[model samples]
Target chain A: MKNTYTDSGAKDTRSGFGAGLLELGRRNDRVVALCADLTGSLKMDGFKKAFPERFFQVGIAEANMMGIAAGLTIGGFIPFTGTFANFSTGRVYDQIRQSIAYSHKNVKICASHAGLTLGEDGATHQILEDIGLMRMLPGMVVINPCDYNQTKAATLAIAEHYGPVYLRFGRPKWPNFTPEDQTFEIGKAITLVEGKDVSIFATGHMVWMALQAQKLLADRGIEAEIINIHTIKPIDREAILNSVAKTGCAVTAEEHNRYGGLGDAVAQVILTAHPVPQEYVAVNDSFGESGKPEELLAKYGLTPENIAAAAVRVMERKKH
Target chain B: MSITKDIKELEAWLPQVRRDIVRMVHAVQSGHPGGSLGCTEFFVALFQYIMDHDPKKFTMDGRDQDIFFLSNGHITPVYYSVLARSGFFPIEELRTFRRINSRLQGHPATHEGLPGIRVATGSLGQGLSVALGAALAKKLNGDLHTVFTLQGDGELQEGQIWEAAMFAAHHKVDNILVTIDRNNRQIDGDVSDVMDLGDLKAKFEAFGWLVAECENGNNLIEIADALLLAKSLTRNEKPVVLIMHTEMGHGVDFMMGSHEWHGIAPNDEQLQRALEQNPETLGDY
Candidate 1:
């Protein structure tokens, strides 16, 4: 109905993970932290410094770190493992699949510096396929919070959740648009702006871009309904169906590849329930190169302009 | 938790366990028997004497108790036999090995509700890290009990083992005791030929682990003594790994030291030959 979501300030989501982890350590003694030699990069130094004995520096061994995290659950401790998203999921998929996902271990896989936003590190460090990889695993709860406050909320949220959880966040200071004190509900879509002309479903860093696109579209007289789909797996099917039914067309946006990310998740949900014309604003099937975060986002067509353009294209394809 | 110096009990127990290994694999006709037979004595020693676990109440969370993890899960036949005979499940269930809906998965799995298996293992080089995590959790919860994991000598080829090795040393997760089933044979051929693991003892020592070796891994007495020694070395600011030397398929005259038998189940005539060598003592499952 109204665009009420506003930017509180620019804060990196990785900091939220660190702050939430520190709080969790103080709140619960069973909360343990493990890192594969990138504690500072992932913003896990707070937890590590607070709980030294409880913290384990896994020393560049992500696969082993994952296994040890899975094992820690057997002794009744909730272990949050920290590393870049590239190493977190793709580097150690088999270990995560066998030791954690298959056994249903209560392990939190905290991945920072996800997507093209990682910047400068190039294609090797950026992990665009993590959402697809994690969501494909059976019984894994995948959450990619948009802003600092939501990331912190999601961090604290996953600790309370049992079984395997993949919490994806990123570096770089972006628009902190979500409510500061809002509780993060996994698998429930958060509607930031509501309009009838188009349904804009976005996740991760792209959520801010969608909000920006909502404004530009509003000026052009095309009201866009922007919904943030944080939890990708166990996707909010009802929310997607209802929003698309009203709008009659949809645009899915993400910092991930269009092949198997938010676009695919929404397509599966809407295609099954309310098949509608849908356009995607995401990374095409290709690798990214070293560049600034803003440049990479623009070069990869992951910006507000691209989102708005996709909305227009999808609306044109709508059945009259 | 102390291994009775009664070499007679383990000696009497070995033939039956060996029989179970071959019989289980032969029944499936599609499981690894070489490593299983090679590590028979080690499994018998761990389940019967090493770990402080109750089979009657097999829980995934083996709290305040010594737990064993088979990192090299291809050797499931021996693990199943040892777990069953140790009372983890009905020994008769061994008859259902690798069958439809059987808890005895081709590899160890937790989803089947199998007891004594805290984590599903078979994908190599993960067990050590999982055992370390369990050990760390025990420390957080103040669990004085220890954790044990077995890795195949061949399985050490997976890069994760080295990673886990580094983590164990740096973090001082001393509550875990990792035993390497040093049967120098993998699926392809000799481990040296497939991927040369140059001086494993030296490698572990360099990784900051308290390393030891059993002169003969398949020897019950040697395995029992080395395991007890490894147990005593825990809580010493370092993890312990026992590199026990074993043949690929020990005891079976035709299979010993041969990688060809690594995953092959004996034919009917070969099964008869294998059974004839070891006298059945504890009775068949």
Candidate 2:
């Protein structure tokens, strides 16, 4: 649960996606890539350099890129499309809905600069609602890995999975705490700590914060159960139900809007099985602005302290 | 072998297609008949002789076979009829046209598990991009088969169509052929007065596509020649665009040249009158 390795360095999940995509290019000839004018930002330069013929520069047109990706599926090519989270969702939702999601194409939509942590390009660029938007579409797999290693594994896994997948990652460097060799599994949650007082469910960059909060809660004699839910849709209902049944309370945290995202996805699972007191640590119906990633997390109430506070509040709400 | 035999065969089957259109539209009480009747000859030519396609082993990766996409999906009645007549599905399923649980929807969709449809396309201006995408995919996969698509002239007004046009040309997507249904009519009005797609052929050429013109889409000989020319124009590098001039209501004299009947389903009386114009080509479905 702790960042025990002192030499551990932080790396952006987008870099992980780029690295994974490069590996895929080397291994699979059918793994073609498309970028909506953000090759360097999405860390797709490695793939582009290695397989120049397979890489398509789609300019700034995300809609066209999505349709093209759908078309590529017909010819049995697995296409990985990269862009900012905002453009990946908002600018091309209809195209994705009709061409990719509806057609059930094997297209990997790799999104970067997710949540308020994207920092500085303001509310327009920092997309906190991408998970909500993508998860709403039926037959679309949604994944938000916690760290670099998990993200790379997810990028590789989604390429092999034969269907539409939205892989959401971020721009900032998070604490690289997950084991480097762990394989990514869809619809499964990774339990980081065991507790009985309350369950703290989180995903994406928020998983790192939830881990920090676990330490803080432990110091306060609060044994908080922490589960990292990388896959948002096809949520780990079994893990959530089991954890909440033991803890009798839960605190959900994510670097996303409170209405939808990991917190909402977790709450739905908990609500259907065992009704329990739940507190959410997420953006409270407000758009993000230009700031440092850590600062934005703090401002948006998604920091470790905020999650710890939410856990305490939920634990208090738990009646014997 | 002879034009007389071809016309006799067409003349025999054209009425059945017409009756199928009317009966299907009447049975469902929904669907665009004008365009279906309008584009019959073109559809007949493609299915009967021109296209090297088979419904049995439908694959999105048409490596060895030609592919066709319906960009203007409102003409589903025609597409569904031709597809059924050509053996993509049991012609009996035609009775369920636009019915719930039927593969035949108001617009063509792949969701119904329709064999020949690769992508679900009801919204205009999207199929062209998908076709271009498929075409590009074919080239990347070393596929020798060509891709084909038909779009309504009014559909050209969509910004996505222009985007696709630019994309196909910029990428030199030469393994695909695109045909514009230059029927000059849309749901709202005549294409020219509605939104004037001025000089579409020139615009396509400007976009760097090899261009062809079909004077009469209903003329089997002309359509066959145009498709052949378009095929020859496809050089595995530059996409082919053909401006197919078609009457919105070709066989049905009462429905031609006016936007009023563009999407209006013919009533029982109108349907009967329309049927009298063309003799039963193939047996009535």
* TM per candidate, chain B: 0.97, 0.94
Candidate 2 lDDT, B73-101, residue by residue in tens: 88888888889888888888899998889
Per-residue lDDT of B172-198 in model 1, one digit per residue for the tens? 889889999877788888889999999
Pairs of residues at least 3 apart in sequence or in different chains that clash in candidate 1? A71-B134, A72-B133
Candidate of highest TM-score: 1
TM-score of each: 0.97, 0.96
By lDDT, who's the top model here? 1
- C-alpha RMSD (angstroms) for model 1: 1.6
DockQ of each: 0.86, 0.72
Clashing pairs in 2: B12-B281, B12-B282, B13-B281, B13-B282, B14-B281, B15-B281, B174-B238
What candidate 1 gets wrong by more than 4 Å, as runs, is B1-5
Q: Give the poorly placed runs of model 2, Cα more than 4 Å off.
A: A1-7, B1-8
